[model samples]
Target: MTTSFIARTTLAVAAFGALALAGTAALAGDQDFALLNATGYEIGELYVAPAQSSDWQEDVLGQDVLSDGQQANIKFSRDEDTCAWDLKVVYSEDNSSAEWSNVNLCELSAVTIKYDADSGETSAYGQ
Candidate 1:
């Protein structure tokens, strides 16, 4: 595998075991995926919740910081079973944040979050 792919895989594997033991256990039919941070900031906290939920589930990143270009694997419980979801990323330096709404998690194996300084826009695309 390529170096970057190896790094991402290593991170994913490291996170999977730790996160599963941290009370976010995996389940059948879970929407396992990768979250790529292309936002050029250190992501302090990451939150994911169903589209209709008012509150986020939890800090999925836990104690980890997702630096620019780093990717983390996001695993969910089968009980979640939601197609639409919301994602929020808080930058570590100043707590500045961005949110992406109604992401279709069901069909996505990876989601790339990007920020454009010129437009002051943050968006996500998944595949």
Candidate 2:
């Protein structure tokens, strides 16, 4: 084989590899997810953080409120290797909050906030 032919083939292979990596990155956050508010009050703050992170990131709501019985899209840049995440929501009425730890964002697409009116307790589940 000619040297020129081998060089051209190597360049083509490299280009193909770069394109494959780009395609994989574009698939991040492909599946849609939402948060359902069932706390019997408005949610004043919503936060999502990686399970390994020590501090919570910014509030996703940003002055918006998720009213009772309302569902809002929870858009995030999902890491392919990490599926666990933490979610927190604070109520507008009394500043009471609920949190979920090590919630798997990969398998679960929706998170519902559950409240017990009788016990005055709040919790969350992923589905």
Candidate 3:
């Protein structure tokens, strides 16, 4: 009888552990975001902000991540600039990294750092 009880207890603990691991995996899946950039340019810096707020939350600069042919939907807004644009990016496959210094994407609603893409390309709404 004692051996049976021990076996049951072990099985119950194993089941609980499995459940915990499954829950952890689910949470981890939800935590990732897509990191998109322009076609030619790699990601030099990234910035993010809350949904309703104007202040931008800057990510670590000079840390290149997005490569060519890769896309991600990172968080951004036009709160800093007067223009209200939707910031979208696409990394070009031709470039190794983007020019972080000269590119001020504040005016673009959706900025695409293309390898051969022009710097002065504007969106419809001046974003």
Best by lDDT: 1
Model 2 has an lDDT value of: 0.63
Provide C-alpha RMSD values for all models, in order.
12.0, 20.6, 22.5
Error of 1 at 4 (Å): 32
Candidate 2 positional error at 45, Å:
0.6
Local accuracy of candidate 2 as per-residue lDDT tens digits, 1-127: 1233223221112222222221212245743469999867788998877665888879988879999999999776655445556667777776656666666566667777766665445656566
Model 1 spans with C-alpha error above 4 angstroms: 1-29
Q: Taking the tens digit of each residue's C-alpha lDDT, what string does model 3 give over 1-127?
A: 1233222222112222222221111221232235434443354444443223454445423355666556645433323332121222222232222122112223222333333233323111111
Cα lDDT tens digits for candidate 1, 1-127:
1233222321122222222222232344556779999977788999988765899878989999999999999877548655666677877876766666556565567878776665555666666
Of the candidates numbered 1 and 3, which has the greater lDDT value? 1
Sorting all predicted structures by lDDT, with the top scorer first, yields 1, 2, 3
- Candidate 2, clashing residue pairs? none
Q: Which whole-number lDDT from 0 to 100 does residue 108 have in model 1?
A: 69
Provide the TM-score for each candidate, comma-separated: 0.73, 0.71, 0.31
CA lDDT scores, all candidates in order: 0.67, 0.63, 0.31
Q: What lDDT score is found at residue 9 in candidate 2? A: 23
